[model samples]
Target: MFFSKQWITGAGLALALLGGTPAWSADPAATTTAAPVAAAAAAAPAAAASAPASLDARVQDLKGDVIRLNRDLLVLEEELLFPASTQVALFVSMDVGKLFELDSVQIKLDDKLVTNYLYTPLEVQALHRGGVQRIYLGNLKAGKHEIVAFFTGKGPHERDYKRGTTIKFDKSTEPKYIELRIKDSQAKLQPEFEVKVWQ
Candidate 1:
């Protein structure tokens, strides 16, 4: 059990009140007066100790409420800005990337530049380890659209290489997801870029 300063003071006061008179010299009047004072003094410490515990619990509960509220706000904002019916997302990933070291990526939607991303060493290593990165998210109309992606990297033999790939697909009432993939071609000893539209 932990004792705060207030608790220790109250305990010492109660002890003083109860032990002030020796047993052999006890007087009825002194005993009666000291009993109530000692009791009240001891109760003060108990009440003081419980107050802080209750306050700490309320603080923890309030922190949990704030986190939940922030998450709800984020979801509401996303729905208002990019509804599912018109939403389009593009992702980048790598597979067996021994032949390439990715440095940057550029994406175009219908010939308009959408996103240009530069990768840090850690991010490139993550993709090489099978991690996928979402590079673009926006609203698109319900019609045919063309997406182009350009990947720049160091290819086999430590030479600079750049490649572009394109795909055309129709969007309806559902969200569209497209993946730009970089893969090592073992047979050709080179890196290949491909685009895939997910249904």
Candidate 2:
């Protein structure tokens, strides 16, 4: 008979499931009166079953606690690995981009190709709905550098369109952040892209 461990440990508890000790164990009191022994015998199985249920609920709660702790540790690890001081980040946004359907974006720093990203249909929908996208994150020396970004998408009358914009800025000891913004030019009836640096 493979009895559960919780049932064994409950022997010393208030219920005294097996009348002070388990039946198989050596105990002088094992030969108790029939009435009290019969009552203990009936109560033992119910107590044993309930004990495991409570223990299983506690185990489940502990698993939840461990999962939450793991997530917190991961967040702390990311901050330690990519501290704000040396981090350079770039984000892309739009201001009522009525004339452009974005397809992709390419970034270059100091004439070196850094990253090229292609947008999905849902990503384009998110951007048009005023969501900002982080285009790049990297470190750079504290000096002057040039950044170039290429925009490729469909233009007016479903025409193929491509354009490039550039900026010259000085990276200081602090972190650098740049926003690539695409805005609708109501006067020209076209989309205009610009790179704006955080002051």
Choose the strongest candidate by TM-score. Answer: 1
Give the Å shift of residue 119 in candidate 2: 0.7
For candidate 1, the TM-score is: 0.79
Q: Please give the RMSD to the true structure for each candidate, in Å.
A: 9.6, 11.6
Reference-based TM-score of each model: 0.79, 0.68
Clashing pairs in 2: none
lDDT of 2 by residue, 70-156 (tens): 999998986676566666788999888879888999999888889999999999889889999998888777888899999999877
State the lDDT of candidate 1 residue by residue for 53-129, as single tens digits. Answer: 99999999999999999999999998999999999999999998899999999999999999999999999989988
lDDT of 1: 0.91
Model 2 Cα shift for residue 141 (angstroms): 1.7
